[model samples]
Target: MTARPLGVEIACDGPTGHYDCPHNAAIRAQFTSRTARQVRADGRRDGWRARPGGLDICPDCVKETTR
Candidate 1:
């Protein structure tokens, strides 16, 4: 996540009602010991990378944290 003027702009939730996205089988519904980090092109394409100013967060992680 990126540092926002107010605070860190972490992902809040997914578009679907479920935190888990059926469309993306690569991602899991829950995270335990994961720490949100910046994504580089060299890293796994499965995850998202933060934009120059925006943060990247998986749909599942976003939903779980928001709740």
Candidate 2:
């Protein structure tokens, strides 16, 4: 997620109203995990990445950039 002048942006809830995707969303709802590795785990699960320079890249954007 990126930062705006106001609140931070979030990539999880997409157009289909779910993270991962709409396909699996029907089987489960979103949950907040209170874990030590939330950021890294979520990134690995969703293909997100927080760069050393402080840039946050979502899965979809990552694909575009790589291509």
Candidate 3:
């Protein structure tokens, strides 16, 4: 039997990115924050990018970029 994902993950959007099983991207998008920082924090909590830009990068990609 094949294992199915419980929730859709928000993948990293660096130079190269792929689907990841981290969190529910849909739920993450439903969240709303008053401040940019808070927005970043929320996104971060969902394994999404916290940086300010049109593009997004997952936590794993963040580590790769920082390195």
Candidate 4:
């Protein structure tokens, strides 16, 4: 997942290397303060990306789900 940017902080356990997973992507978007969003997998090798949602509370929402 590619995030425009964010200003929030997040801690992941499953995947922390790439900003793809909807969970992680949410963090990057919320924390980094990203606007434009898009989630596309180039191929099997590539993972998923986070696209823009109607709301802004994303990463935080992810954290809540994990809990």
Candidate 5:
């Protein structure tokens, strides 16, 4: 079976915002090595949550938020 890409949970500051966010992209790029443990640690440090599943931010969100 194919393994799913690890996803990081970008915590909502106030209200439930779009999943696609620059912060999420930055974090994912920063942790492309797939060191989930380290990613999680870093996420916690950065006030985000890195975990499993398809929680990665979507491209639309990235475009909208980044712009």
Candidate 6:
């Protein structure tokens, strides 16, 4: 049996409704190969929450955290 690829979910603490955020797009592009487990682990380590869904991150939140 083949393992299904889990959809990546982003749990942002900032503003909601980031469906059009470019940073979210970049994240999707950047971690195209990252498994759901990996993303969850990283989120745990970074104080964020990663689940399985169609969640997204906004550009302002990205700038605030990454800076």
- Candidate with best TM-score: 2
Rank by TM-score, highest first: 2, 3, 5, 6, 1, 4
Q: Each candidate's lDDT (Cα)?
A: 0.37, 0.44, 0.52, 0.34, 0.44, 0.47
Per-residue alpha-carbon lDDT of candidate 1 for residues 1-67, written as tens digits (9 for 90 to 100): 8963321223422333345333442323232313333222312354533333343445454454468
- Which wins on lDDT, candidate 2 or candidate 6? 6
**Model 6: worst 10 consecutive residues (lDDT sum):** 21-30
Q: Which segments of model 5 are wrong by more than 4 Å?
A: 1-19, 22-24, 28-34, 50-67
* 1-67: candidate 5 lDDT, tens digit per residue: 8999765534322112433354444443254645655565555455454224435334434344456
Candidate 6 Cα deviation (angstroms), residue 64: 8.5
Runs of candidate 6 exceeding 4 Å displacement: 1-14, 20-34, 50-67
lDDT of 2 by residue, 1-67 (tens): 9963432233433332223433222111125533424544556576665555444556655564577
Which residue pairs clash in candidate 6? none
Error of 4 at 46 (Å): 18
lDDT of 6 by residue, 1-67 (tens): 8997556654453534433543343233125436655555555555443324545344455455467
TM-score of each: 0.22, 0.41, 0.36, 0.19, 0.30, 0.30
Quickly count the clashes in candidate 5.
0
Q: Is candidate 4 or 5 superior in lDDT?
A: 5
Error of 6 at 61 (Å): 3.7
Error of 2 at 12 (Å): 9.2
Candidate 3 versus the native: TM-score? Answer: 0.36
C-alpha positional error of residue 25 in candidate 4 after TM-score superposition, expressed in Å? 13
Of 1 and 5, which scores higher on TM-score?
Answer: 5
Worst 10 residues of 5 by lDDT: 11-20
Please list the Cα RMSD from the true structure of every candidate, rounded to 1 decimal place.
11.7, 11.2, 9.0, 12.0, 8.7, 7.0
After superposition, the stretches of candidate 3 with alpha carbons farther than 4 Å from their true spots are 1-11, 15-42, 50-52
What is the descending lDDT order? 3, 6, 5, 2, 1, 4
Model 1 clash number: 0
lDDT of 5: 0.44
Going through the candidates in order, what is the number of backbone clashes in each? 0, 0, 0, 12, 0, 0
Position 49, candidate 3: lDDT: 65
